[model samples]
Target: MNLSKTELNDAELSRYSRQILLSEIDYAGQLTLAQSHAVIFGLGGLGSPASLYLAAAGIGKLTLVDFDTVDDSNLQRQIVHREANIGQAKVASAKSNLTQLNRLIEINCIEQKLSPEALEPLIAEADVVLDCSDNFATRFALNRACRAAQKTLISGAAIRWEGQLSTYDFRNPDSPCYQCLYPQDSGQELTCSQNGVLSPVVGMIGSMQAIEAIKALLGLPTLTGKLMLIDAYSMMIRTLNLKKDPECAHCSSALTERDPL
Candidate 1:
């Protein structure tokens, strides 16, 4: 679709010219992308690339939540923050970079932990939520919140050259929530701290998460109800179909209620 000169200024048009050229995301889709808001959890490896791409894509607003501060170790994967920002809160550093990437978008930096109390309000306001956190606690927290809010959740995780991406939409009756595939009580333990991660692997998966979020917001088909696994070591990509669990407390209850539980 053609965009009026006023609708897309020279700078705006130039910035997204390549993306706007795509028929699926021309001026109209770019407009929708520019008007959408996304909430991203974490500010580490996965979050770093996801937030940067979304901001660069001209997402109208972004809410970034991260309780950590920039560190020398993060420089390897968290490309959004610089060495100069080592001591600064990750959210602040990320916001600063995002603002520079796209001045037209609004960004909210929450330099606080993602607690249950704060999850609902933030998730409610976002058209889509990106779960880029590394830990299970935060991941589960985000999943629960998104399920309750019936918001589409795009989750990505990367460690040791292996990455996984999944979309959870509790609003869809047959869709599986994150909790359905990975039970909170399963007691599976894995972390970047415990296992090394390739920096580029995080970037690859995180950027895909941003793509999924944008697709979800634009009502385009996505990886929902499927888990995408990637092994950077072998450059192999696999898709696993996910099914809603009848015994999953979070999704099962929502299923029974026929609404966000």
Candidate 2:
């Protein structure tokens, strides 16, 4: 990835004028977002709106990873895929839709499953990684890879009228990793297919992930070290502070490696 930033043309400035007008995202912040690369895993409900919003928000580049084909049932919440795209690969559908939204942005599609070796390089190159995947396996893998790469990770999940959001900034020595919250071999893998999820639940969480990713790219305040829990049934939201696990196998050693007594 090139380290240089992209200069916005008049068209781009006009296109993103409303977003640029925000104090949080002035011209400089918009430029920072345009120069950043975001890697997103899974194109289901979460990734759908996350990618779409980020693309519309002017993220310079996006690498979408998903090995699933669009299904008719997914149309309920996976808004990025259309009824005509039932059999199309998720990354392919997402890339097409995202490109249509913002031709100025570069979109990469990965249609195959990625091993940890394949995942780390992509995570390392990304300014921020969005773990929009539903399964625990993929979430743990992404957390581990992001920790190794020292990249910021915005993770989101939703199921059964509940949603979760958090940021793990590995660049900080005391930053807690996902493994710190969910230990290895710990997640029960309760899926949306089994429990059922409200459509907007994932949308809300995923949109928040996009915001956190943009904040991460622009060096702004993010949800790092805090977990936001949403109970959509009652419309309640709560945030909990997260602490680094000194015994965590994934990040504790990295901390010790950097500061050995």
Candidate 3:
């Protein structure tokens, strides 16, 4: 994605004034966000809020990926789709809602499952990538892609009354990746639909994902190399520091290969 003009017009200044007012963000940070492209995979509970906030916050371009159709069951927590969109594809429904929120931003929709080839180009184009995808396969796939590209990836997952968030800035060689945290693929995956999720648990994590994405675009401090764990039932949040694995399959070898000769 091309970096759009940093200049904010009269209407843009008015729309994003509150964010621009923050000393940390100010006008320059907001402009950086306006020129950044965020690629979000999955338009479910987590992706819904993430996409909405990113769009409303004035991110210049957003690429939404999801192959599922909206279902009545999804309305419990997926806020991007409506009753009328039950049969509609998730990316389509998300694009409609996000466009309604911010018409000035560019929104692209992908309605198919991505192969590694497909994901690579998206990762290459994105300033930041959000892995809101459910299964570990997709998560691992995305982690590998981001690591190969040395891009920034913000990932979130929620199941039952628990949720977790993490950011892996692959540009920083010291930053641990998603695979560093979950090295093995568990055959069986836990999902909100199969177990149960408190609706707001996903909302909280998703909203935080958007914040991390914006911070990435603006060079702000983010959750890179730390895992945030939330348990709604206990009302507790904990962050665990992560370290790069020297023997890890995904990144360690690559890091060694890039070592100074």
Candidate 4:
């Protein structure tokens, strides 16, 4: 993956003027975003907001992966899919929405479930990875791939009235990967299909995922080692510090190899 930044045109600068005016993002940061490629795992509620915001923020390339078709049940929180797209592949539908937002950016649509062989190469080309998949299997696979590729991953989950957002900076030797926080075999999966989610709760978490992704791509401060919990019902937000586990099978070896002693 080329790490070279892209220059903005008059139209792009004008479109992102609001973001550029901010002290943190200015021109250089925006250019960095234009150079970055982000891979998103799911095209459901979380991926909808994350991908949309990333596109609007001017990411140079985006790879969207999903095998499912848009269903009416997803309309409650998955804003990217519309009534007209009920039977279309999610990646294709998402690409349509994202391209309409930013025609200059590149959108790679992968309308199939990624196998281990397929995932590694895609992750190797990304500047950052977002785990928005509903199942634990995909999340664990993504965590391993990101750790091996030394990429930062922004993970988000929402079900019922609660939501969670966090970043696992696997590029940092001391940082904890997702498996350090939740073991692969630890718990049964709980999805929005089984429970229920408020419409905006996912938007809230997915929006935060976008914010962290932009910051991570620009080399700015991010929520890389902290977990944020949201209670949309009570409107309470809490953040907890995260620590790397010495016993974590996936990332512990890297940390051990880097130990100075």
Candidate 5:
């Protein structure tokens, strides 16, 4: 793709000139980002920041999926929504905010919940998937969908001062999946509403999610097969090497059949 014609014009060149200066994300990388589409699973805390940055970064198209509506309580962390947006659909609010951020980008608001039946097609069309949902069921569903579709998935979670980030790419057979690190039967349950979360903690982690998504879209090195943990209270960051589980139901089951070992 011609960077000058397909990616940026004189107007866009003026808009994105600073980013175009980066050697790593020059005209070519910006073009890759501009042509790529990302699917964001939730529109709450993490989704709010992730969508904002991705749009500002010149990602060509973004599909925002969320069934919830904005509420007063969400204002603390969901920076995309405002006092006037309460009761409005989160996707709609997100689309409005994103458009204001970058008019050159296209934003599609899917005001519906994500389901297993609807997962494959969306995952297939996306260059990268961001998991910002607050619940395990949605997260697991996204993981399975990405794995089946062979799409790159960037997952993040934040509660209080703690946050976790990880990337899963099924294209690499050796990369560990979300289920590999946290088994479905591990029986751990947590929710933002119940556990409580800090607003900036979500911002910090969600921004990282956006970074990973951009890197994945540009075919740059990402957090594949690694977990990044953050503690806001102490302002500490830690990276942990993740291993593919031999018995990982999602990844291993397919490997066993293909290898027939």
Candidate 6:
């Protein structure tokens, strides 16, 4: 991150005026946002809102990764795409929308599935990452990358009228990663297509993910050690505390490695 770019210019101050008005994210917070970089691993339901808000809020740089193309089915919740974009790469579509939202920032689009070798450096450079991917493989890879990079991750999922959100700040030794909450062997993966998801349910969770990402960038309190569940059908929200798995292979090993004998 360039320290000099942390200072918001006149147009930036005016552009982000509403956010700057908040005492929590005044001039300094906005500047922090301007200097930060966020990488989003998925560009579907959850990634849609997350990328939109992050771009609109003036995150200095955004790296969008998605191997899929825009399908007509995505219009129901993927707000970042348009009907004309059907068949286009998701990252390209999202980049177009996000660039329109904020041209001052840089947007990098990767239109392929990233191997571990490709993902780690990107994670290492990001201040925060949003795991909006829909599969366990991708999620586990993202968790491992973030853990190794010591970056914060905001994870969100929505399916069948239920949405869940959690954050893992790898900078914190006690923070439980995605693997800790959901082990690698945790049965089959549930997807929006197989189970069905309400459009707004994803919008809600993605928006919250964006909020948590911004807060993490600005040094504010986020759901780092807690999981939030939203039962949209019942119109209820619940939060549960998360604890590190002392014997887990990922974060626990890092903790052990850092501690003295």
Identify the leading candidate in terms of lDDT.
6
Per-model TM against the reference? 0.92, 0.95, 0.95, 0.95, 0.94, 0.95
lDDT of each candidate versus the true structure? 0.85, 0.89, 0.89, 0.88, 0.86, 0.90
Q: All predictions: root-mean-square deviation over Cα?
A: 3.1, 2.7, 2.6, 3.1, 2.9, 2.6
In candidate 5, how many Å is residue 24 off?
0.6
Better of 1 and 3 by TM-score: 3
lDDT of 3: 0.89
Off by over 4 Å in 1: 1-6, 253-261
Per-residue lDDT of candidate 5, residues 1-261 (tens digit): 123346467777787789889988899788888788899999999999999999989888899999999999999999988898899999998898788889998789888775677877788889899999988888888888788777899999999789999999777877788889889898977888888999999999999999999888777899898999999999999999998888888777555332110
Candidate 3 residue 169 Cα shift, in angstroms, is 0.3
Error of 2 at 57 (Å): 0.4
Candidate 3 structure quality by residue, lDDT tens digits, 1-261:
465484888888999999999999898887888888899999999999999999999999999999999999999999999998989999999999888889989999999998888888788899999999999889988888888888999999999999999999988978988878888653577977679998999999999999999988888899998999999999999999988877677666555442111
User: Could you tell me the lDDT of residue 223 within candidate 4?
Assistant: 83
Predicted structure 6: lDDT = 0.90
Residue-by-residue lDDT tens digits, candidate 4, 23-46 = 999998888888889999899999
What's the true lDDT of residue 109 in model 1?
Answer: 85
Q: Give the TM-score of candidate 3.
A: 0.95
Off by over 4 Å in 4: 1-6, 254-261
Better of 3 and 6 by lDDT: 6
Question: Which pairs clash in model 4?
Answer: none
Model 6 over residues 1-261: C-alpha lDDT tens digits? 646684788889899999999999999888889888899989999999999999999999999999999999999999999999999999999998888889989999989888888887788788999999999999988888788778899999989999999999988878898988998898998988889999999999999999999999988999999999999999999999998887677766555443111
TM-score, predicted candidate 2 vs. hidden true structure: 0.95
Q: How many clashes would you count in candidate 1?
A: 0
